[model samples]
Target: MTDAPVRTDPSERMCPSTPKANATVFLGMITPAGRVAYVTPPLAAEVALAGLPDPTEATESRYRLAGPCVTSSCGFWTGDHCGLGERLVASYQETGVPDEAALPRCAIRRTCRWYAEQGPAACPACSHVVTDAR
Candidate 1:
């Protein structure tokens, strides 16, 4: 049998092709209240099954479910690495949260990486808990 590709940690895979900060985008899951709850790669199998919101149909009213985080807070963040966490923090800080009443349905519910990683639990900051809508 042929050998499978070497499996690298998420941090090592942060920038495979380029050394620039914007070379690649790291995925993260935030809350409806504009807080970064989790961060990981998009290709993660668990992410694909946790159910995320559709970017096309996503409205500003919807919670920012997945996106690139700035490098500072990213698990892979480093001086020589991309600034994904910094970018995410900037974006989140600039945008803030949307109106709670206008939040839209999550499209990636079955494939959300954060949900799969964290499971249904209360958010540490707001104490808001996540439940499977399905």
Candidate 2:
């Protein structure tokens, strides 16, 4: 296998789908510790056969589910800049999350656009970013 890291678009990052069919890569469902884990195609097929329900859809919790990989053409993007990343950093600062001192050890860092644009400061609030959380 090539040693080069996978490069993902900011608009295309997504949580893994349950019964994660054909998912070769996954971001773990947790806090700053979440790491992108790789799954082989055969293993993904086996998981699909097990009839697992999507955790995020099945509950009214703040946590996320491992589901299909998807993308969001966020309104925040402007001329290669990420407004959402800026907002995330701002929110952390406003709430005293102490974002600047550290960043989560994320698996998607190499491929993440926000990390590329905003640097490590965006990771602390990254986990709390759920689609339509409002």
Candidate 3:
């Protein structure tokens, strides 16, 4: 079988170093309660609306973004960076380790400016525990 595509550098992705003037899609912010608080960039809201389960339930939490930012070299970033790792850590602390393998694969994984440039090991937002996709 072919190996899953590897993303070696995030800097090569299409992430903008600055936020777009009219770009309305933002990443979702993970709350301390382990609930994803929809904020910024309307796209985040849309994803949250469609993807997130009821916050009141105790099921495994899904992945959520903290909002688009130029934290990596993306044009979507403002000066304020979305600390995905810290937020995720907090979420895990409050909620518990998520079923990382069960979580849907991020579409941006291949071209994610962060994963490409920084590598997965450096990502504070990603879970260190890996499970077989199969």
Candidate 4:
């Protein structure tokens, strides 16, 4: 039999590392030591942006953001899946993907693009990513 395509709920898919224009959900802050510390219950990115007097404080280097997943528009979209999420999970598999119980308390897990495509495996790898490394 031919392979059946897996259907996903596309309406709510959230891109975990979106640009400021697309960002609506504040995912978390990148720590001083360079690890992502997730924020739960999903805060609006505008609230976080409003609190920052300095524009630099709103940078991706300091905070992670999430927004509506724009497939094809994004470079990481591999037609039906997120190429970046797949790569991150594959690379991190050498270490280990966390159990569901051990995944971070993320703001957008329910609709997160990486989580939706890669399952719990994406979380551990996602925790270490910075949207803007500079």
Candidate 5:
């Protein structure tokens, strides 16, 4: 018996809440309800950044971004999977954990690091994550 090899290709895993320095896609905006109002097809991060006239406004607080997963370099990496994703799923399990059918429509899911490792369980938790650059 052999265990399947873990997929570690950086190109195939996206960080759904990356900082501006690493962001490639503007995933969504956090709405008044505090849940992410996801971008359906995904927009280029630069396009969104270019339109933001307020240089003083921090992008992380209002927008969710996606970028290549910096697995080991990321604080959320737990060697085998995302520690943050694990924690989020674990926390939600104590409450009403959404099923795969409830997953939100968003770009990068095919390659999202959390979704890849944690499956549909990551979506519900991810919808509420606001990137804290501080």
Candidate 6:
């Protein structure tokens, strides 16, 4: 089979917990509860440096750029599948977390790998993972 092209088109949406860099397009914020809160007029740069009236440091492990497409640069990818998504699903099952919850109102759900691979079941667990919640 032909290898999937390394996708780099900006995602229509992004996951908050995913590691992001300053150059990433700021589309949304992952609330403390793990729900994604989208920005109406997405910031062109990191929120911490957006020069807002009350700018706060983009805490090292807190917020990062998330978008609507898969990042081949991510270490979790294996061909067209996301290894992290698989592990997240398995972790949820091992923890006895029920996989029957309403899908989150995610801006990137349509293009999210976890959502695509694990379906609605991945949402509940997605909230629990952060770029640096440890």
Model 4 worst lDDT window (10 residues): 1-10
**Candidate 5 runs further than 4 Å off:** 1-11, 53-55, 95-99
Candidate 4 overall lDDT versus native:
0.81
lDDT string for model 3 (14-84, tens) is 23111223122323343566534433222433333444465333122332432233464533244453344
- Model 5 worst lDDT run, 10 consecutive residues: 1-10
Candidate whose TM-score is highest = 4
The global C-alpha lDDT for each of the candidates, from Candidate 1 onward, is 0.32, 0.44, 0.36, 0.81, 0.79, 0.53
How well does each candidate superpose onto the true structure, as a TM-score?
0.24, 0.48, 0.29, 0.87, 0.84, 0.58
Q: What is the C-alpha RMSD of each candidate to the true structure, in Å?
A: 13.2, 7.7, 12.1, 8.9, 8.2, 8.4
Please provide, for model 6 over 15-134, each residue's C-alpha lDDT reduced to its tens digit, 9 standing for 90 to 100.
434544423444355577665455433454453336445445554244444544345765667877777777878888754544445454544555566777777667666756655523
RMSD of candidate 4 to true structure, Å: 8.9
Q: Write the per-residue lDDT of candidate 1 for residues 6-117, one digit (tens) a residue.
A: 2333433222211122322222333666543433323332233234455343222222233333446555456544443234334444344445443333323233333233
Best by lDDT: 4
Q: Model 2: per-residue lDDT, tens digit, 1-134?
A: 22233334555643322223323333344334443222222122223323336433422132333332333443555655666767877787644444544554444555455666666666666666653333
Q: Count the backbone clashes (under 3 Å) in each candidate.
A: 29, 5, 21, 0, 0, 7
